[model samples]
Target: MRGRDRFALPILRRARRDATLTRPAVSILLPVRDEGRFLGETLASLSAQTYADFEAIVVDDGSRDASAAIAEAHARDDSRFRVVRAQRAGMVAALERGRAEAEGAFIARMDGDDVALPGRLETQLEALESEGLTACGGRIAYFPRRLVGDGGRRYERWINGLVTPEAAALDVFVECPLPHPALVVRADALAAAGGYRDCGWPEDYDLVLGLWRRGARFRNVEEVVLRWREHPDRASRTDPVFAQGAFVSCKVDHLRRSLLVGWESVVVWGAGPVGKAFARELTKHGTAVAGFVDVDPRKIGRRLYGAPVVGVEAAARFACSFALGAVAREEGRQQVRDVAAAQGRREGVDFIAVA
Candidate 1:
């Protein structure tokens, strides 16, 4: 593990109490902190799930507001709602607490500020059981569309396009391939992967990567099932741990551990900013960069970070067993992949597109 323990299962502090609880078909692990304004509406969405055989395990992670009271209000009328006081633990710990308190065969994720579309649970449960997937999520839409930025919209598109296990796996190196709040995962599969952990980056992304590395089958429902609320205080946008550098560090660490092991050198395709940045991260993780490959006449002969920039043909001749295509544009990535394929480079085995 590069940062905190990867998939380290924590001992649930409330397991003894949870054992006597009624078991539901699905457990929604929702961790809320200072989300009083949105907690009630979020709870209502869960309460309205067409599949009624589900329980919402809401963990209050030391909220300074009425979030707990809001959750309590819902629990009073809905037997499916249970609130766990997590004092001051962060989101990852709170999620672990929620999982410990969960008594269902499947686990679903939700945020205090998000809304689940109608039939979200029923659709996911059916897909899970019918397709025999270890975990599955659905397409997501950012609410108050005007609040969403260009980057967020692009990310939403890229993530939702990964609708199969292979697609998700292929893009796992680039970024989190599934929407965390829209996922329904098999309980046993989750346990087998050691549940969630404080991985110093995005905890949801770390869990998804862990599960994918464990060979978990993943898929996404074609329809939108989650209304992802966007705001200035959103974790990803404000949390230092979810910063761009943290994500890049986490990805490089995982790739070094799982995929780049035993590889001495790699040819970076695309000498642009994205490619050079990824190359630097990979180097910091002890992987040697053979050089950069690019088609630009201006860059082909230059040296970046002490590595020579070569044309596509020269890159194919480099003394490296693997290559990482870090181009950001779709057309550029396709061109890079075509060049690699022409050179007999294989995806997953010999190369991967990181952009």
Candidate 2:
């Protein structure tokens, strides 16, 4: 036993032991806050799951509206559904509380506003077991079709495109490939990854990155399992915690801890705003910027943040241990990959796509 196997053995044993217990095979942690309008629909979806042997733990985080009552109603109607009341703690605190009360081999996440497809749990569990994934999610379709914006459609396509663990890992830094509401994770893996935290960024992204750091594999099933609701009151739309700057900060922090470890300097493969912002955060974490790589002729031969902006042809001359592809556009990111490969640099080894 060595490497990940050494860490994974205990989790596997724990899964086996938990399976033998009289508990539900899956525990769905649903954190609700003033989701009165949509709670009933979400609960109904959960009740309709093809895999019926699961408990839905609804954590009501001090909702002034009828959210708690709605959940209580569901609890009364369905024996497997239970409502836990907590006073005004945020989402992370609610998740932590739900996790503490979970008694299943696998822990699934659900949002009070999202609708889980009938086969969501059954499919995710099968993938987790068959593929040996630490956590698994599936494709999501944003509902109220007319309300879903261009960005939402793009994001939906991008997330649904990544079905394999390798595809998810390669683009993990670009965005959270796993839809939080669609996730079903191994209880032991979640516990080993330290559950959820109020990390000043999106908790879902933080947890995914933390799991990746611990050598946990992730995947997305090839079918749509969640009808993700898009509305004005959604936290991602209003919360500063899910802001672009916060996401960038989180990515750079994890990048510093993982790929940039022991490296004194790195070369950013874009001189645009995206690359500059990433480099700025990386610098704050004590990593020096060797240079910025750019294809634009005008931007080349300039200096930004005390680092020279050089053309792609001259980027390899920079004295840096690793290269971060921080281009914002997908086409630009792919271009970075092509250029890096031409320079004899490997994607995950010598370079990484950060945009």
Tens digits of per-residue lDDT, candidate 1, 202-273, equal 888787878877878898888899999998888878888888778887778778867787888888888988
Q: Each model's C-alpha lDDT?
A: 0.83, 0.88
TM per candidate comes to 0.91, 0.93
Clashing pairs in 2: none
Instruction: Supply the global lDDT for candidate 2.
Output: 0.88
RMSD of each: 7.2, 5.1
Q: After superposition, how far is residue 257 of candidate 1 from its true place, in Å?
A: 2.2
* Candidate 1 to truth, TM: 0.91
Runs off by more than 4 Å, candidate 1: 1-22
Candidate with top TM-score is: 2
| Residue range 1-355, candidate 2, lDDT tens digits | 3324433433342222223346887899999999999999999999888777788899999999999999998888787888999999899999999999999999999999999998787778778876789998899999999999998998998899999899999999999989999989899989988889898999999999989988888989998999999999999999888999999988988888788887878999999988999888988878899999998999999999999998877876964569999987788899899999999888877799987
Highest lDDT model number = 2
